[model samples]
Target: MMITMMKSYRGKLHLPMLAGVVCALAFLVLLYNERISFLSSTSFMRFNTCAARRAARDATDGGRAKIDDMEEEDKLEYDADICDITEGRWVYNRSIKPLYSDRSCPYLDRQVSCVKNGRPDSDYRYWQWQPDECSLPRFDPNRALRKLKGKRMLFVGDSLQRGQWQSFVCLVESIIPKDQKSMKRGRVHSVFRAKEYNATIEFYWAPFLVESNSDIRIVGDPRKRILKVDSIAKHAKNWLGVDFLLFNTYVWWMSGLKINSLWGSFANGEEGYEELDAPVAYRLGLKTWANWVDSTIDPNKTRVFFTTMSPTHMRPVEWNNKDGIKCSNETRPVKKRGHWGSGSDKRIMKVVGEVIGKMKVPITLLNVTQLSEYRVDAHTKVYTETGGKLLTDEQKADPLHHADCIHWCLPGVPDTWNQIFLAHL
Candidate 1:
């Protein structure tokens, strides 16, 4: 059609007609290109805007997730502050593994290392402390070391406190290199130092928490445990400037129904001694210790904690086991809540409360007594020593008179005490 039109117009082709045809085609082509360029620019702007918005939204969501995690941790810490952790029950969870084994910790005393001494069963190590309202965080050894950096945590009391010290050392030292740690097992003031942290976890042998005849690291006579109910100068000198002081004096104070109390020097040949009822002597002794704490301890420098009386499972009949003797052959915890055995004196704990209650400086009490009463299975139970020596074959055969039910096994109840302790810190 264009060829026929062009042939008819070829002879009559005029300059104005040719110019008008060319101009019309040029106008149409320019308009089409301009429309395509406008659509392309619009599409690019829309894509760029959506992509930038999506990236910003993703960043905001990530930040919110991180903030939520931090808030949860803060909530846990708050709950721990409000709840009574001492009111917990012992949950026998089989999945529980000890923080450190007796074999792994060379710092363990021969007495409390029941696993290494052939206790035969490991069921006692399985009981976990579950609080009624809040759960304790799993203990972190590295964090404990950081918390105790450049500090001295001194455990002052009898052998039971010594056991707790041992458990704490094992917990933190498991992560420490051998070259960075040292143990000084002195007769009176034993020390375990982590050189990297410049921190020491020590035990000062103050059985009565005052001057006592049994303060002799190894006593010649076990029957003559006497307390000079008004003396603290000698022991308090060692306790000065300690950062964390954990004081306990229950089992050692329980010698008999009556204890010998003295008013003068032990060098005076027993001339100033009088027999007082055990509770009376205990109260007098604590008064002396509390006076020392009130006067000598600068609360700004030292944090004081008193562990409640750790119970003893001597007679199984109290737990309704007529066939058993001492804590021997026990493989499980006491099922009853608030179970108090015949061995643990509630009167002694009352004295502790009254003394600490009247103190001038603040002293937090780690009330692990009731929870510990449920753990009859955790005692050394004849796998321990009587006088710093492992029990003989003859002593092992007689579980009634030889089993050391007073001290709990390592990686056992004392670990839980340390757990509650870390929660406070």
Candidate 2:
């Protein structure tokens, strides 16, 4: 009976030992599975990070990469055909240097050559336009001049358009020999010719696009501006047979809710002006221009571009400056995203869009207003000269009096504008 009792005790001990072994095996299995899961998750996260970086590079590099290699989550859906390149943000890139400098390009107007004329800051010259989907090719003056060989290009409208024209001149002139190019200014027009290429780039001063009292070579007063809304032939006659035409008219149209439109010519002695709602008057003026293009221009031969209004940075409140502070002394662009300053008129853009939409002729709209709105620091501001005269002490003290926030600095924002324009061409 003692032997039987010992056997039972041993059996009981053996049962507990077997249970402990089973528990240890189960714990090992659980740990192994957890480690496998962790490794799989880490591998997936690494792959996703690499894919995201690749996608971003492809998006900015002109969308040349194929999407087949990308996973569903990594694929970027974009149609280059429908994408608007002008609609994008300005990214800080150290790689992109200015295409031209104020000192290098002799053709730059003094008013727009802010850096060459002794502006202190150099940061504005470095910022580049980063389109949302694709990259804009850098401005190659030789290629542009080659493309324009035997062609004539004209920029029509206000001083803002003149700024763009000057930008184009400087861009193209850099590649040409000094002796082969010539620049001449007439009463109402300025011409820059690449003699060997037989190409001409011209600017005509027509603030209203139609004949107006403000059409004089020198506009004295902003308030005294008057438009003949229905007539654009006086200016359109000068635009005929141009290989490429760029046009802009906006700041002059923003005079008031009602524009003083004259029914008769400015040369007539009789002075009677009727008030027309600004938008209505704008539409009328655009329609006249559209009619002129439709009736005269051969879409197959001529490429027309209407650069949307260039934004102005005159208002201090828009950029959170003091009441008296304008765009002067601004050293950098507005860093905020989607910054639509009060300077650009959306109503005017809508009018332009509606008018262009109805036209039978093909007119490409260089929608540059939004891109330019962020470049508040790129204007001529107080560091500019007009008519080759330095700013007097009085004008320098009063920044508001001599400050020009309308025209952009050459080798600055306008170079990017030409880049986009050339991309389309």
Candidate 3:
């Protein structure tokens, strides 16, 4: 199973591989040049306890209990295929330092460079996700580069996806010789190149997955979002012929109770718009994306993966820290297993599962939500930037209003996400 992408590289569609090394990560890289496309959830506890719950509920009925016992028994069985990687806890391991420091990765975005942003503690980098049933392979850049040889891997959707994209780049970029590597930034798309392998790691910014007004990397009013829930071709055209596509979108859709959705083109001056409940709009948007996958992709040639919604830590009250201001000053992970925060919505996750379940294409879901929920301390908090600018000392001083609880600190949680991502490959 695999989950990710390369977008156009602006070369010809279906361009055969340039015939060298593979280095793409996340969404649409075209195979005509070998495009990689990156393409998620539940209370995990609710599923984990299914067998036990069945045993209890069926105890009174001997006939029903017998059948349920056999069926539910299958749920507890563990194989490499059935390993519940999401049902894990964060272990504080001081021995395991990050593969790349914020300083080492020149491409590290200011939004998640906590250490460079005057963060005093490095404890957050020490915790590793330990699966109760099996061990995760430690991240190896050389091996990962080999996995990506002659491939274009694409990471698509929102800034969190960008964080995961950045994590993958930082993990693999350090080893390539200076002359062999290059990074290019664009308004809607970006590519990190490794000439030695003829590989490209790329990212495309499509915040809502489907077309949206907030598709740009930076927006004037971030909260005033609008979606073209019925369309995707505007973005999906670049994803064509990608070998691996990794994708995600959720936080941006939850900005308010109602989301403004457009029916026509963004060129039509925002006409044919209507206000619908966020969930209704979300379902339509996902359906549009699903229609593209079912109609366009050939699963045998292109592996598609959708990362589950990344969790947030904005409300300290959700974790029982009544006095804490969001994730501010927090330096330790939440120890509770199956800890579901308010930041992660079960309803949205349900939509993801339902839509993916209905798709004819085989899309591997990188379920990182449950594991990340424990990393309450991993957010950039007040140390990160806003609107692409570093926060001032005065703004950082105000943790309550200024703390960024949505994005994870690099070399912190996103590295773990990439680890889970690598496991599938």
Highest TM-score: give the candidate number. Answer: 3
In model 3, what is the error at residue 240, expressed in angstroms?
Answer: 1.8
Highest lDDT: which candidate?
Answer: 3
Worst 10 residues of 1 by lDDT: 37-46
Once fitted onto the true fold, the runs of candidate 2 whose alpha carbons sit more than 4 angstroms away are 1-80, 217-219, 266-268, 322-324, 386-388
User: On residues 274-345, what C-alpha lDDT tens digit does candidate 2 reach at each position?
Assistant: 778888888888888888888889988988888888888888777776754678778778866667777888
Q: What does the lDDT read for residue 147 in candidate 3?
A: 82
**lDDT digits (tens) for residues 1-425 of candidate 3:** 11101123454642112211121221124313312222112342222222433344345464365421233223322232334566556778898778999999999888899899989899999998766435677888998888888988999999899999999999999999999999999888899998888888899999898987777634556445668888899899988766789999999887788988888676566766789888889999999998999999998888888988888888888788999988997888887657888888888888887787778887778888888888888899988888679999999889889999999888988898788787768
lDDT of each: 0.75, 0.72, 0.76
Candidate 3 residue 33 Cα shift, in angstroms, is: 34
Using lDDT as the yardstick, the better of models 1 and 3 is: 3
Model 2, poorest ten-residue lDDT window? 37-46
lDDT of 1 by residue, 194-223 (tens): 999999999998888888777874454545
Provide the clash count, candidate 3.
57
